[model samples]
Target chain A: MRQDRSSVRTERDEQFHDFVAGRRAALVRTARLLTAGDTHLAEDLVQAALTKLYVSWPAFRRADNPDGYVRRVLVNVLTDERRRVWRRRERPMAQLPEQPGPARDPATGPADDALRQALRDLPPRMRAAVVFRYFHELGVEETADALGCSVGTVKSQTARALDKLRTALRPPGGAAPHGAASHSVVLRQGVSS
Target chain B: MMDLHDRLDQFAGSPAHPDSTQIDADVARGRAALHRRRVTGAVAASATGVAALVAAVAIAAGGIGTGGVGADAGTGTGDRTTANGSVGASADGAGDGRVRLVAYTGAQPKGFTIDTVPDGWFIQTDDNYSLLLAPDRAKNPGPNADPSRDPVYDPQSFVGKIGIMLQSKDAHGVPEGTTVTVGGKDGVLVKSRPAMTPDGSQPPADGDTGWELYVRQPTGIQLIVQFWEGLGLTQDQMIDIGAGVHVHKDAAQGVG
Candidate 1:
């Protein structure tokens, strides 16, 4: 009995370690976006979610969809954290005016910064829906399931979020010129709404 | 000219590897949590069995004659007792029916107090800024309960929860909710159905409800009381929980 228990523990630990090693980066990136680029907060969210996933590892491993289970846990943690008044009260230093500007990668520019701000401005649930739909490329039903909401909710929230993003990112003179390269990218991405 | 989708894609660009040190620490925490859960489950199981046996013996002895097992069970704290001995049903008139206020002071801001919550619910103060009240059915399952069959850890299992936090500096832009008086102080109350999404749009969930009260205290402390409707708790009961909240200056300062 002791040997069986020891081997089971070792097997569970190995599975958990492998899962975290493989998925931590992706989960952290998603969390960073959810937290609007607060690396520390993003890491905290990811860690908490992983811990929760570990706690329920037995059930999750037996289930047919462990990835979905983990994603749902991440979404739930993000939503709960966002709802906290103290968390809302605490602003990242990047958001402070007196602080130096956020360090931008060479590939990123003023437009990307504006887009990031716009995304951060979105409501928490809408942001999750948008992230799942656009970034993770989950289907509408899948995003709804991840958010524990209905597909209609996902569609409406995504539409409204897209509208807000367009308004926020629009150039000085109306919409981008027809057939502009970026416009083509948007069209190809199928989020032109 | 860039579309929102492209921007999001760029924003979510390649996932960078996380720090190995952090991962190790997190894994350690996970292992610790697993150990704690196992220990807690064992203790809770034994306690439940003992309580059941005691209740059965008392019933056979005709010691607890009336009110069924629930009333008799209420007199015993079972596993729900806190260190402060604030877990029992209230004898005070403030309680409604069997629902008594379970005084809670854990995980709250300094000077924060939730004088009472309904009985028969499990209260958790492990979170930094909230007090979660989950039904007995929702807490970690005991020996007799199979978690595989009865998953209680989901958020929906919670009947009601109260969160108290210090108001942020940039809270002026918050939309004016319904004006009301709580604990002799003026506050704004906002009630929404299907709970407002993070972006402030009402979702399509018709049954879920959320109530929030933002009270500006005389001491420049902004207290927010938020309750999610669950476990058959009415709006009035949620408001009552908010009204009973008391905060003092000394206790309100330096909260995380």
Candidate 2:
């Protein structure tokens, strides 16, 4: 029993170990972003998903797409958490996420700051859909899968989130902030309201 | 689709991974649990009772099952006892009705509706932080000996309250099963069994010592365990300790 036990255990755990070694970083990063820069909560979410994966290892091992399975588990845990009342009761941490220092594209300019602030101010659910779609750049279906909702919901939420951002960041006079660049987007997206 | 795709892709540099060491450690814990359960030595009756409670728990947990407690007696208690070191022996002698045990403590200093609790009660690891509980009832909400009525919901049905109920129970660890009468009805017992090494309980010719646990949730449905070969504590002692624990319901858990 001793001789065979080592072999048997290795056979059982090999796939899981490989998956973690290869994909752990990506999963952690996604969890980090989803948690809005809370590294600690992100860690908890990743562990929770991975722990569940271990419990259901038999099924997960044979699944066609294990990464997707893991991602689905992560998002499911998050949304389930959102709906639970006790989750609402805990005190939020006092730490602040290191804000992305200014948009990388100089041409995008100071307006990007206002737009980003507007986006961050949205409700968590809407923000998640928007961030997954725009910032994370996931497909509608993928975003739906991650958020455990339908594509149509994602589309509408992203659109509404965008419209709100545009309105929030819009210069009061309906003019673009300096660079006269706002004129360029106004014509492109018909933002002439 | 195209516009949204553009935005999401901008940050697709790559997702970061958690440390490999962390994942490995968690996997190790899970595998260890499987082995620890394997080497346990509970007696046949207690083992049988544990199996029944597990089946009931699985049902309460919303998993596939044969649907009732009758199947527990039919299972092979010997093999199962060795598989799960503890015996679950908390079944009720009471008639059909629902009973719940909720414990609160001095944790969460900012929250209200909190009460003080005794020390040393072991909360199930996952549930330690949750203050709300939804105790799922086993298939046999009452004693198998008396089969007159059935309950409507099990603890599994109390899904939304997992975090809160779990926390309250976590604050106080249960060492023995203590029964009490609440609302003038016979209350069930709540208790815990301490950590036992793999070699502690070995059945003599298909017998070994094992700890006991009893549970009935979402009201009625009780399970009692007897560890291997009578070497461990009796079902009666388990109940005595279980009956001593106290449980109170919250508006969230109590709500329909």
Candidate 3:
């Protein structure tokens, strides 16, 4: 019995290690967008999600979709973290000048900073839906499963999120004569893809 | 016109990957956490087995129903109501009759008691905060509630919650409000916009208002009772809740 338990533990650890090694970068990228480019918070979210994944390794391995399970856990962790009052108290203001200033990598250009700020301004769930649907390129059904919501909710949230992003990123002067038509085409391509 | 879709694609493409060393550290941390959880589970199982064995032996010895210890002892019970109808019944019977203040000896925090809470309100405490009194009508999505749909951090969901936080000294930096006496202790009552969102974003204009009473004990401990105005609780009622607080003089600081 002891030997069996030891072998099982070793196998589980090996599988979890491999999963982490292969997917850590992608998970971190998703976490960054979810946390609005707060690198420290994104790392914490990834660590928490991975730790939870390790705890449930046996069941997760038995499941048909391990990536989906991990995605669900990641979203849940981010949600729970946001609900904590102490964490809320410690969070920096949304419109703080220092945030956009320091996050601007000279190499990445100004557009990246503006996009990050726009994403940051979104409500947590709206932002999560946008990230999972657009950034991760998950189907609406898949995003719904990961978010533990119905497909209808995913569609609605994604639409609203897109609306907000469009309003935030709209050109200062106004939409060009052909901008709306081109934007629609781009949005359709994104949704279809 | 910049396409939002392209912007999001570019945003997602940004590589913020942790270094290999950090990954290794995270793996080690995860392993340690798993080990700790397993040990805790094993310990809990062993304890349960021993307790069952002891109970069996005691029963065989004809010690079945002799009240070894009263689990509810020192836990406050329903009693008389004050003139203001603040607290009257046991916490278990919140809706039985007039509100009854009970001594809260919960694991998270001590030395404070809630006098009056809306019917169907439940209390949860996991930290130094005195208690989180959530409305009964709120759907408890349990631990597995989906972030995308339920959005646990939505401020509207917590519109009626009353949170009591205990701080050792006046470090909260709460802007001073009108001075009021609560439970024979002088306290400052301050009103502010509801708490910011988890990401430090301002709540919508229509969000609930926040009322806080910071009462300083003679022992230098500060007891803060906070509630959202969306619950429609009156100032007198809020004050009465603060006034009904019974702080145990012998309670140690940060015991929670």
Best by TM-score: 1
Q: Tell me the TM-score of each prediction against the true structure.
A: 0.56, 0.41, 0.55
- Predict model 3's lDDT versus the native: 0.61
Q: Give me the TM-scores of chain B across the candidates.
A: 0.45, 0.21, 0.45
**Model 3 per-residue lDDT tens digits across residues B99-164:** 433443334335455555555555543233344566544446677666356433332233446766
In model 3, the clashing pairs are B78-B90, B87-B99, B87-B100, B88-B99, B88-B100, B89-B100
CA-based DockQ, model 2: 0.15
Of 2 and 3, the candidate ranking higher by lDDT: 3
Q: Which candidate is the best by DockQ?
A: 1
Give Cα-based local distance difference scores for all models.
Answer: 0.60, 0.44, 0.61
lDDT of 3 by residue, A68-138 (tens): 89889888888766643331221112123454322364322234676787888787778998888776678
Ranking by TM-score: 1, 3, 2
Model 1 chain A lDDT-worst window of ten = A86-95
Model 1 C-alpha lDDT per residue in residues B67-166, reported as the tens digit of each score:
4566336555432322122342233424435355556544554445566565665554323333345555566656687544543444323224544555
How far residue A45's Cα lies from its native spot in candidate 3, in Å, is 1.2
Docking class of 2: incorrect
How close to the true structure is residue A93 of candidate 2, measured as C-alpha lDDT? 23
RMSD over all Cα atoms, model 3: 15.6
- Fnat for every candidate: 0.30, 0.15, 0.20
Candidate 3 B-chain TM-score: 0.45
